[model samples]
Target: MNGAVSPLMQLLSEVETLKKQIAESEDPVLKESVGSTINAIVAYGQEAYSEMTQILDEFETFQKMEGLTEEQRNSLLAQSLDHFKDQMSDHEKDSFAKSCEDEYKGIWESLDGDSQEFLSTARYLGYALRMRGRGNYAPVINEMCRVFENELKKKIYNDYIVQMTQKQVVDMDSNTEPIKTAVSKKKKNKDYFISDTEMVCFIEALPSVKNNQSGYLSELKKYLQAEKWDIQKLSDSQYTKSAHNYIDNYRNDSAHANLMDEKKAEKCDRQTHKIIKHFIESKK
Candidate 1:
């Protein structure tokens, strides 16, 4: 029989053996490390660590089959293990795509079908979760900001612009006039930028029992002929504020920053999810 063995198989075997020994040894530090290694392997999805054991067991059974020669058995054993790995790889991708559907279980139930579809397709949340699961926090931080900025763009565009033709948007009302002037006259030909702080102020200006016709919301409703959104969501809420602060604090620096340890990563991940689910709820 050929003695050649796959390096990946050897490494996985070492990890499993180390995991088992650490389990029985009562060394908290080693056990913690082993758990972390397993988690890294499972970034695609859970059960990857268990999948290794299942492959080994199947290969052992295949090795004992009577018909094949020892050489054939060894070759087939490697093939079986490789096949299992391939299956796991494919399953990992499937898990990622599927998780995009409902991983934000917190707000999934609150969204309408269209809202659910939009949030699911956002993809940044999925990317961030995958990074966090792999013990990588930098991409997670970026994804969190991506959720905020892109969703805000989507909300404004779909809610307001889609309803009007180009001429109507410019000629329809006085509210859009300032927007037109800002876009055309700004230095560097810069477009008007939307911001979370501005949103907070705008929401505060929305008509209440006292004032009904003199605010950003009222003017927006006039020119754009736009309907109200989940206005409460656009307000200065804990989730919204945190999401804004997360973008401000991390987005610029995360690219060149050092890797965060698990504790920091955990906090980052939780905040990312908070931002994602909050946006999901805010979707109109």
Candidate 2:
């Protein structure tokens, strides 16, 4: 969420101006011009503003008092989805289990503020039920797989930042096992390989945001070899290459294809939730 410019600020300024303008403007063409200009202002704030009307719009009301914290904003998102699922008569044969209600609340709250914000995109994103052509199954699977991979990156990057703070690994190195072993065009089978694309996306995509990503890949490898971390601990501080292998293989088969049906969507979400709990468990 863009806390710098909240929805309440927009309402106080832009909405009031629009109301005054609408009252004063008598000509239809002039009113339409004014309306379009206000709409354009909303558009410039963020493209997601259009799609996430329900969740994002809530900020306008609450931000009047004070802007939301990362967790509060995420809670709002979770609440919106949960409210709909519970109130609206949606086909239960389509929704993902543990992705709603108290189950989701626990998972969402378990994460730290930053991690909650990082993972909240899963809440409002990829409305598989809304996908017209592809049906509900494929999109749900795709979204869950995507969230899993991104969560891994976030967790690994978070650990990497901590290591830098403590001067553990080279002040800027990350010990991560990527989703793919090789940087190939193919993601379907991917066979067995490790690629830096996932970590690179975090490190290089925005230097200001990922300030800890300073050292080269070679430094991390050198540190790992010299320190001799066990394979289980070496894997993004979660599990070994085998865990990564299993995830990659499962995701490859589940996502990137529309072969699965609606029931599989629930299965994907439920199974993913279980594995993510393991991934986020605090390692001693």
Indicate which candidate wins on TM-score: 1
TM-score of each predicted structure versus truth: 0.44, 0.36
Off by over 4 Å in 1: 1-91, 100-102, 106-136, 158-228, 236-239, 255-259
**What tens-digit string does per-residue lDDT give for candidate 2 at 142-229?**
4455455556545554333334334433323343333212222123333332322344333322213222444434334333334443
Please report the candidate that would top lDDT against the real structure. 1
Regions of candidate 2 where Cα sits further than 4 Å from its true position: 1-101, 104-106, 112-136, 158-242
Tens-digit per-residue lDDT, 1-284, candidate 1 = 01122323345556677778776888888788888876665452345445544654454466447676433543454454344425433434344335544556666555444433333322332332242354434433433344455555455633443233333232444534544444344433444444434443444444341334443345454432234455556443565567557755654334333453445544655665676566665546
Give one clash count per candidate, in the order shown.
0, 4
Model 1 TM-score (2 dp): 0.44
